[model samples]
Target: MRSYLSVWRLPSAPVLLVAGFAGRLPSAMVPLALLLMVQQRTGSYAVAGLAAATYGLAMAGMAPVLGRLADRRTPRPVLLAQAAGYPLLLALLVAAVLGGAPTAVVLAASAAAGAATPLVSGVVRALWSRVDPEVRGTAFALDATATELVFVAGPTLVAALTVLAGPAWALGVSGVLAVAGALGVATSAAMRRWVPVPDGPRTSPFATVLTPGLPRVLLSGAALMLGFGALEVAVPAFAEAAGAPGASGLLLALWALGSVAGGLWFGARVVSVSLPRQYRWLLLGVTIGLAPLTAASSPWVLGALLFLGGTAIAPTLTVQNSLVGSIAPAHATTEAFTWLSTMATGASAVGAALGGALIEGPAGVTGSLLLAVAGAAVAVLVTLVPGRRPTRGRAPEPVAA
Candidate 1:
């Protein structure tokens, strides 16, 4: 408690935490809201799914570019511009979908809306680099936990709003929240005081991706999320196979609940292990924990294993975030974080696709679970591979946290 309080007491911490949460609500809301809205209008799940995928791919593909812009120009103008643009784009999407626009126009609108999504997640994470070193781990843990909660809350809110009014209302509220939250983060004191690192040869667009010890970290993150993507599919399938399909949501929520508990516990304690070692051990823990799921015969058994395995999720992410802050070049901190987001998003999509195929094949649920375990094991292996040592004369300065 005191450890987390210490983080909250830092200057601008409250505003950053609050606004960051609000700004990111759209991330959780938009996919489902868009899916429901488009499905409601078009009466075609395939079209809805394609629109959602286009939106997500656009968001992931553009994040690194926006992050680079923020690194070069500071986050204030970038976030401010996004604040105005994202909602307008989303509004256009809603209008097009509701007004019986052509399929091509709707797809284009979805892509534009996603491309304009606020860069709040990466920017807030980079801002955490500014925190005092002593409690930075706890701050990252809290941020991870808050993010977990957002997914849980965002979906629930969308469901309620969709029932109360309609999918359009739910999406409209998402736009409103995005505008308000982005504006709040953009105008905050921390953002106002942040200075862009001066441009140099080391600060070039691709330089951050080439930083020492970063590629392995990014690979490890992508692998971890790949496992997560498989688990997301397998769990629901597990519940359906057990004759209680509705239990899937509850089971998954319990999994997230366990992660929240683990993150808080991990954050509050003092750790002596190096971040690299911690990352490896956490990956191993996830693999070990996930391996038992293949034996789960009922939703109760599967849910228990899920909750236990989930204890490693947020803690792993906390360590991963700390490693990025400690390993990324100071000149491109925001871009480094954005790359992490990009890798995770892209990898998770692949994992989901693979998991769906595995479930439909002879592999079935067991195969999907094995794929999840294999993904985590791959992350562990990536961590064991030696990373490039920093070159002489142009060594990057780690972000101060």
Candidate 2:
């Protein structure tokens, strides 16, 4: 509590937190809203799924490029430009979808819209790194928890809007939120004064990727999210199999609730371990927590296990954020954080695909759960790979390109 209060006391923290949440709402809302809208218009889940996937892939593919631009140019111009462009692109997408456009046109519009999605998540995270070092961990923890809440809240809001006025209305609201949130952050005092760290002799295009200890952190984070992606699928399937399909949402929400609780608790404490060691142990905790799910024969049992397992999720993310901030070159911090988002997005897609296939096989939901555990275990192993220790308390000096 004291730690969180310390974070909240920072001058720009409230504006950043609120605006960041609003700006990131679209990330949660758009995919489900777009899927429902396209499916309603096209009357095919297959087409809708493809469009949604295309949108996500486009966003993931373009985010690092935009982040790098922000790293060089500062986030104000980048966010301001995106704040204007994203809503317009989203409007175009909605128009194309509702105006009875062809499938190709709709898909292209979805891709364009996603490519223009605001860079709020990365920018906000990078800004957290600029906060005083003593409370940076708590700030990251709060950010991670807020991100989880966004996914939960975004879907609920979309469902409400969809029920009231249909998916297009839901999507339009998402665009509004994106624009307002991005503009708010872009015009903030902190963002207005932000300047990129001056480039060093070794600051090349690949400096972020080549930073010692960063590759392992990124790889482990991806593997952890891979587990999460599978769990997302497996938990719902578990509910459906138990003859309580409607309980799926409740189960997943409980899982997120547990994560929020864990994050708040972890953030308030003082950690005694190095970030790398803490990262490994947290990954291990995820793996151990997941291993018992194979034995869950009922939704009640599965939900309980999921709630317990989810406790590790945000703490792990907090450590990952801290490690990235500490090890990445100051010149490329935004890009480094964006790469984390990219890896998580891409790996989660793969995990979801793999889980979908495994769920249909003889192994069924059990196989998916095992895959989830295996993914986390692999992450633990990745952290043990011999590498330079991540420097704490400050950004590392740039390595040779």
Candidate 3:
């Protein structure tokens, strides 16, 4: 606790922390908000689901492009542009939903809003590199923990807003919050001071700031998120099937709580471990924790298991972020982080759809849970792929671009 407090006392750390939290709050709210808005407007969950998937896909597709831009220039311009554009796009989406606009139009607006989603998580994660070396790991751990909190609270906020005002208001409020947070960080002194270093001539067209080990990092991230996506859908299905639909949220919250606990504990450790090795061990824990979800017959059992499983979430992410910082070229930190975000989003989307289908089909919740386990297993496999030794104290120099 003292160590975390000390980190916050550093210049601009508090500002970045608060703004990043606020900026990412929208991510938790937007999907549920969109679901509620579209479902209320169109009377069709199928359409609403499609709209939500479209939004996720669009965000997944555009994050890399936007991240690359941030790498080429600086995060400020990219973030500022998003800050100005995203809310407008969200408003347009709301108008289309309420006005009985064509499904295609609503989908288009959703994609547009997604494309303009502020690059908050990436920017905040990238800032850890600028912190003192001794505290960098702690900073990353705190950041990951905070993100877990965002996921936990974001849904609660959406539910509250929907009950108090309506779904449209919930969506609108998220847009406003996202805008404020993104703009706040973009204009901060820390962000401005951290400018991009230019990439020298590179042979590979696909190469950005991503270094050799990053592909494995991204694949691991995807697998982790893919398992999470399955867990997200499967938990609800389990709750409903067990005749305790209300337990779904509680179970999920328990999972987030576990993640928070894990992150704090992981961060506070005073040990010196390499990122890749820590990541490998975290994935093992995650797989072990999640493997039993298939056997859970009631919400009580699932909740306990989920909380245990969730303990791996923050630790895994914290290690993943640390690993990225270790290996990413100095010039492309933001882009590298964005790629991680993109792969997670894309994989989660796919996992959600697959989980839902499996649950609806003969395979049932057990199948979905098994798939989640498989995803985590795949993550472990990816982590084992031979790569350069994990960066320990500084960003690796770019390979002869």
- In Å, residue 334's CA in model 2 sits off its true spot by 0.7
Please write out the lDDT profile of model 1 over residues 1-401, one tens digit for every residue.
Answer: 99988988876788878888888888889988999999999999989988888898899999999998998888888888988888889999999999999999999999999999889989889888767788889999998988877877888889899999998888888888887777777787777777776755755657877788998999988998898888889999989988999898788888888888888999998999998999999989989988999899889988888889988988999999988887876667788898998899889888988998999999998888899999999999999998686332232332332
lDDT of 2 by residue, 1-401 (tens): 88888888877788888999999999889999999999999899998988889999999989989998898889888888988898889999999988989999989999999899889999888888877778888999999999988877998999899999999999999999998888887887778667677755555666677788889988988898898888889988888889999898888887888888888989998998988889899999989988999899899888898889889888988899988888877877888899899899889988988988899999899999999999999999998889875543344332210
User: Which numbered prediction scores highest in lDDT against the true structure?
Assistant: 2
Q: Decide which is better by lDDT, 2 or 3.
A: 2
lDDT scores for all predictions? 0.86, 0.87, 0.86
**Candidate 2 clashes between residue pairs 3 or more apart in a chain or in different chains:** none
TM-score of each: 0.95, 0.95, 0.95
Per-residue lDDT tens digits for candidate 3, residues 1-401, read 88787778777788788899999999889989999999988899999999988898888789878887887788898899999999999999999999999999999999999889999999888887667777888898899999999989999999999999999999989988999899888877687677567665556745753467888898888998898898899998999999999888999999999999999998888766767788899999999999988888789989999888888889889889988877877777887888888899889988988998999999999999999999999999998888765343234332200
Clashes of each: 1, 0, 1
Runs of candidate 1 with Cα error greater than 4 angstroms are 202-204, 390-401
